[model samples]
Target: MWPASRIPFQGRGGADFVEFSQVQDPSMSHKVQPLSSLDDLRAVLRALPGPDDTARAAVIAREPTLTKPPRSLGRLEDLALWLAGWQGRHPPTMKTPRAHVFAGNHGVALWGVSAYPPEVTVQMVKNFQNGGAAINQLCIASGVALEVTPIELERPTRPFHQDAAMDEDEVIAAFNAGFTEPLDGVDCLCPGEMGIANTTSAAALSMALYGGPAETWTGPGTGVAGHALDTKIRVVAEGVALHAGAATDSLDLLRRLGGRELAAMAGSVVAARLARVPVVLDGFICCAAAACLKAFAPDALDHCVLGHVSREPGHQALVAKLGFEPLVRMDMALGEASGSTLAVPILRAACQCHAGMATFAEAGVTDRV
Candidate 1:
C-alpha cells in the first residue's frame, strides 16, 4: 500500500486469540525492527515450486487443442496458474474450504483515523456471532466454515482482555501455539480483519516496511475524507516515525503499532504455509498482514490467493505487487473477509470446469479456432 515495501513487517491465524491495535507516531523515533539475521529470514523462504514450472506447462501442453488458444480464456488462464501452484501440479483441488476474519480494537483509533469509534469492534464481533454479519450470512449460505476471532492487542481499559490477544512477544508465542495444525486438508483459507481505524495501522506497517511517507499509502477508509483523512495520514506518519526506534523485533513493531486482528491474520498466514493450504486474500488490512507474512516466510506467498478489489488504494498496490488477479471489481470495503466468502462459489466453479470439462477426443468434438 505504501510507495514501497522491499523489507519485512509482522501481521494472524485461527483458533487461538484476539486483541486491539497498538499504534506508533512518526515524531517519536527513527529506528525500526531489523531482521535478526539474513539467514534467519532466509531460513523461512520456501523457494516456491522452483521457478521452472515445467510440469504445469506439460499439463497445458497435454490439452488436445493448440490453435483455439493463445491464453484464449484470458484471465481464466491466470487463475489456472495460481491453482497449479497450489497443487504442485496442474488440476488443483478445491475442497473443504474454510475462511477466517480476524477482528480487534485499535489503540490509535482513540486518535481518530476513523469516523466510527473503536467501540464498534465489540459490537461487530457480537454481530458475527449472531449471524447478522455479511461474512456470517454468506458463509452460512455457501456452507463454508467461517471463524471470527477478536483479540485485544492493546491493554484493555476494562478488566477482561489483558492476556487474551497478542502483544509483541505474544505474536510469536501465538504462532508457536498454532504451529501444530495440519493445513493440507484445508483447500481454501481467506484472510479478513476488523479494527476501528485499522487503515491507519495498515499504513503504519506499510511505512515501516517501505520506509516511505505515510500519505503515499493512506486512503479514505469508512467514509473518511478531506481533513479527517489528511489527519489520518499525518498521524500515521508520526506513529511510524515514533515507533520506528522502539521496535526491536517484528513482534515489537506490531505491538507498538498494529491492530489485534492484523496479528491474528498474520498467524493464519504462517499456519496456512506450514500446512500447505491456499488462502484467499481479502482487503487492504488483510493484505497488509499478508505482506508481513510474505517477509517472514517468503514461501507463504505460494499459499495465497487474492480475492477481490478493495476501494482502498492500498489494497490495489498490494494486489499488483503480490501478483494476484481480483475476482471482482465491486468497490467493496466491508472487510470481515466478506469478499473471499463471496468469491468462493466462483472459484469452485473454476476448479469444477478445469477438472470436469471433457477433452476434444473424449467428447468427439474437433478443436477449432
Candidate 2:
C-alpha cells in the first residue's frame, strides 16, 4: 500500500499525482514556507545532506574479501559498494525499490516536434494505470512498486519556442509536488518521465547546460524524420535562443527550458538524496533532471546510478558530460521507466551477491598466489 500522506494532483481526466509523505529526517520536519521563488527552492536544496563517507569506506574495505578474484564481478562489485555507501550498510540489500513515472504534456507538441500526437501522453498514462505498459510489466516482474505521477496532464506547458514553459509559481509548485509524499521506507528510487515532445525541452535544457548547438542535442523523438526532424531541431534552437538569459543559472535554465515533469523529477532527485535513498536514472528525461539537480545540489549524483544510455541522440552526450557509465545500453527509447525497472533486478542481484557470498576463509578456499 502507498504511504498515507500521498496526495493526488488534479489533471484533465483524473488526478495524476503521488508523493512520499512523512520523510524521516528531523531537519526535514522544520517546515519552510511554501516555495515562492527559485531562491526558496535553492534554500531547500541547500539543506539536503550528502552521502555517508564512512559507510562508503566500509564497503570499499569489504570488497576485497568477497570470495572472488578481486573485481571479477566488475560493475556489480562497484554497484554493491556504491549502494552500500548511500544505504550506510556494510552489505546493502534492496529491501524496497520504487519507480516514479512523471507524465505531462509539452506545448511544443503542438509545433509538430514529434511523430506522435500529444494525446498519446494521456493514453500512455492510462496504459500505465491499467498495467498494460512495458514499465508496469517489468516492475512487477522485478518486484518493484511503481507509481505514475501525472503533473498538469490536462494543461501542457507553454510552447517553449515562443515562451517559458511555466511561470515561476507553477514551476515551484511542480518542484514542491515531488516532495509532498512520504518516502520514508523506500530504499531506492527510479525516476522516469512521459510527455510527447518533451525531448525538445530536454534537448534545449541540455544545450543550455552542456554548451552545444541545438542540433547536437536534438533527436528523432517518436520517430519523426526529414522535415519533421528539422522542425524539432529548429524549435529547440529557437527555444534556447529565447531563453538564453535563464541559461546563466541552473535553476533559471530549468525555469526557462524545462517542463513540469522535468522540474518534478528534479525535485524528486533532491528529495531522494536528502533522504539518503539511492536513485537509479532512466534515459534522457531523467538525465535532464539530474543535470539540474547537480547544479542545485552538487552531491545529489553521489546517490545516483545510471540505468542505461538511451537511444535518444542527446543522451550519449549528456551521459558523457556527467561522467556516468550506465548498466544497460539496449538503445531503448520507451520512456516509461522500462530501462530503470529492468536494472532493478540487477541491483537486487548485486545486493544478494554482496550479502550472501561467502569469503574465501569461510569457504576454506586458498587465496590465489
TM-score of each: 0.75, 0.89
The alpha-carbon lDDT assigned to residue 154 of candidate 1 equals 39
Q: Which is the leading candidate under TM-score?
A: 2
Candidate 2 pairs with clashing backbones: 19-181, 20-181, 20-182, 21-181, 21-182
lDDT (Cα, 0-100) at 230 in candidate 2: 96
- lDDT by residue for model 1 over 92-146, one digit each (tens)? 6666667666666666676666989888887877676655667766665555666
The number of clashing residue pairs in each candidate reads: 31, 5
* Residue-level lDDT tens digits of model 2 in 35-143: 6778877777677775578877877877777689988888888888888878766768797888888887889899899999999998988777666678766776777
TM-score of 2: 0.89
